[model samples]
Target: MTQPSPHPTLTPQFCFSTVALRDFLRISRASIDDSITQNLNALYTPAGQGFDPSSTSVRAPRPQNSRQIAPSSCRAFKDQVLFPSWQVRSDVLNYCASVATSPDPDDPESVLRQVESERDRERVVNERLDPYSARFFPREARTEMLAAVVRQERSVEKIIRARSWGLVGERCGGDFREWEEAMNEWRKAREK
Candidate 1:
């Protein structure tokens, strides 16, 4: 009797031409991107205005250790760019703590979970400390926001395209719609 192979081999159920496979993949990616864009729009539209810093005027003290001398609104916007509010911070910290403490120390999956939790906790703490840091901004909006805030006049589209910064900057829920809304709010505030 023939011995069964130790490693399982995957057999293709159907043959696909290279072009067809590429097209399918392309369509799948586009569908996912569109869904994400739609969801972001729904979650952060006209009603979710409070979190936007550009829409309000405040004379709050400068954030600790920040060297930015930009307009107060801009500074305020940057301050709340990460995590949205204190509630998010608390929840994130608690979740990370739970993940770090509840797992078996010797299990590989548990070890990885602990390490990831520690890293996430550290990132959240760092973001809380310096939300204005460029590293916290999404790739698509980072340079554009910097340019606008610093009053630099230049086309950012070419740069964004060259860098291939995904069609919809979804990092940390940051997207073009949010960026556009923030920009419009800032412009209106500036005009006042």
Candidate 2:
């Protein structure tokens, strides 16, 4: 048989218009699930040795720093195992629900207003259960609650602006400042 060429030939860039992006996304999700399952299995059974984080004990020499680090490290592990799946599932369900119940795409202003209204309602509920008002409503309860609501509302508004700017930048390939200006214009129009 003839000897193979010493150097392999490089293939030219072929246009791949046949593949749908959704197919790639599905493949990626499958691969991620497989990897996560593999990792979980390895973590659960190290060389066929059953190991549980809750039952595991660290026998390191007690150090002054151990007290501070131990609780936080345990918390980190607990958070990783408990929160990730719940967050992913909740996000997927929320996205599906939003899509199923989405309002008219042409009415972005109405959607924004609805979001703000929902936020305000949440603020009202949160204010009623404010931690600071636990014992009993003092003389300044109304003033304090009003101030807390305003502060919380401002924080929520800031979060909304940041998220909106991120979406605007992604969709329009523009800076956040441009988004902020557009937001201001929208606010003025809404005020009218």
Cα lDDT listed for each candidate: 0.33, 0.35
Best by TM-score: 2
Candidate 2, residues 100-129: lDDT per residue as tens digits? 343334432555566666765565334466
Runs of candidate 1 with Cα error greater than 4 angstroms are 1-15, 34-39, 49-192
After superposition, which runs of candidate 2 have C-alpha atoms over 4 Å from their true positions?
A: 1-138, 175-179, 187-192
lDDT of 2: 0.35
What value does the lDDT take at residue 107 in candidate 1? 37
Q: How does candidate 2 fare on TM-score? A: 0.24
At residue 82, give the lDDT of candidate 1: 18
Residue-level lDDT of model 1, residues 38-144, one tens digit each, is 42333333343245575468667764423222244233432332112212222333333333344223333445555666765576435566776425322222223
